[model samples]
Target: MQQTPSVLTDQLAVEIARLGIVGESSDIGTLHRVTELACQAVPGCAGATSIRWAIPSGDAGERPEPLASAASHPDLAEVADRQLARRRGPVFDVVEHRRAVSSDDILVETRWPEAVNDMLSRGVRCFSTTPHVRAPVLVTLTLYGVGARALARSQHAIASLLVAQGSAAMSNSLQYDSVHRTAVQLQEAVEARAIVDQAKGILMHALGCDADDAFAEMRRISQTRHVKLTALAQRIVGDQGLPEITERPDRTTD
Candidate 1:
């Protein structure tokens, strides 16, 4: 028995929701999965490709740069490559308009003759491009069909939903990476502070000086030796001795 469109949509939704779990996969992984699912979700879709484009900084006139791409089949990837290399096609048009672009038959498509020829040579007769925007990045999902007018307008909703879910997953993954880096930096800073305090205490006992005097001397030695304060502190704590410092000739008198 053939499944209804509603059933296929529900199944796709469930699959897409699984991608929302942060740290479950990287952005490339998500894009690959999305392309695979696009073929399954859209009726008559022979293959699918997902390309990620980075928005140009401070230059709206500059074209968006393609960062990565994932395709369900080699032919689909080749079609995308041709479009990107030529800098004109449904993908670029979708990005420019921030809307979906579709061609029911490439043999008669006149807007991008070169891209149309590429697609026809690859046995792709119909295609659609859908845009999904996440800040700093724009992702496009393209579905290919082997027969003319094979892709129906009804299938566009499924394609849009897949890219939307893929975008959310990517956003969560980026946020997780950012938070992990910040946590690592904070831990390193705490460790550095503890070691520096230990080094200062060692200085105070050996020099018979107050905390301020000990810190000042350590700072002077650190600056004169061109060593990082944290590195000098770690060395002092490890050896339990002050680093030798050459006194600068008193230039203040001159």
Candidate 2:
């Protein structure tokens, strides 16, 4: 029984709503859900997997590997790993181009010969990969089929929409992580400032020096002892005598 495209779209929308809620809890959980949805939504889909990599910044460092992955079957992970090892396949193509790519017949796909052989060995006759673009990252959602010509060309739109939803959820997750990191960093900064101020007050009282002088003394001690300003301040707040240093050692060795 063939399902109409509209039905597939509606199903994808419902799944997306569920994913949105799950994504709020954990990005990994959302990814796993997407894999399950991919298998359920796409016609002839025997298995599905999702992979994501952070976009490289300056120097275009070693192409970042997929940070998260989910597969319908355990064996599919092995298949994905083999392709990842080779850095080739429909998934790679989608990541590289930020577009959707598919193989209607893996045995005859010339672009990724190694992946082709691997998928064939694993009974994956066809597969499709769609790019989910999230700034600083690109995710590839893939659906695997067990028979040649399993995916109809008409299904590409549906596959892409599903991937787009997954990408959106992933982007939200990334932003959430970034926000959390920023909050942590800000809290640390605030704590460090508070400690440094307290230590400065102590120095001002002990030496009858101005705030600037107290801060300068602490800076000098920090530089000479090669200790972090926060640690130095902590020691001062603890009423420990400032350690005297005769000379600074060179520490440029990698």
Please list the Cα RMSD from the true structure of every candidate, rounded to 1 decimal place: 3.7, 6.6
lDDT of 2 by residue, 1-254 (tens): 22222336665678666665424646567677777777777777778888867777766545656887777777788888888887777777777767788878877778888878877877888888887776765778888888888877786776777667777777777787789999999999999999999998988787776788778778888988899999999998998875652233223421
Error of 2 at 8 (Å): 4.8
lDDT of 2 at 24: 60
- State every prediction's TM-score relative to the real structure: 0.88, 0.73
lDDT score, candidate 1, position 141: 92
TM-score of 2: 0.73
Model 2 residue 236 CA deviation (Å) reads 3.9
- Which lDDT tens digits does candidate 1 get at residues 1-254? 12113336676778877866777677888889988887777888888899888888887899888888999888778888988888887788898889999999988899888888888888888889999887765789998888888888987988888888887777667777889999999999999999999988887777776787678878877998999999999988898456663333232433
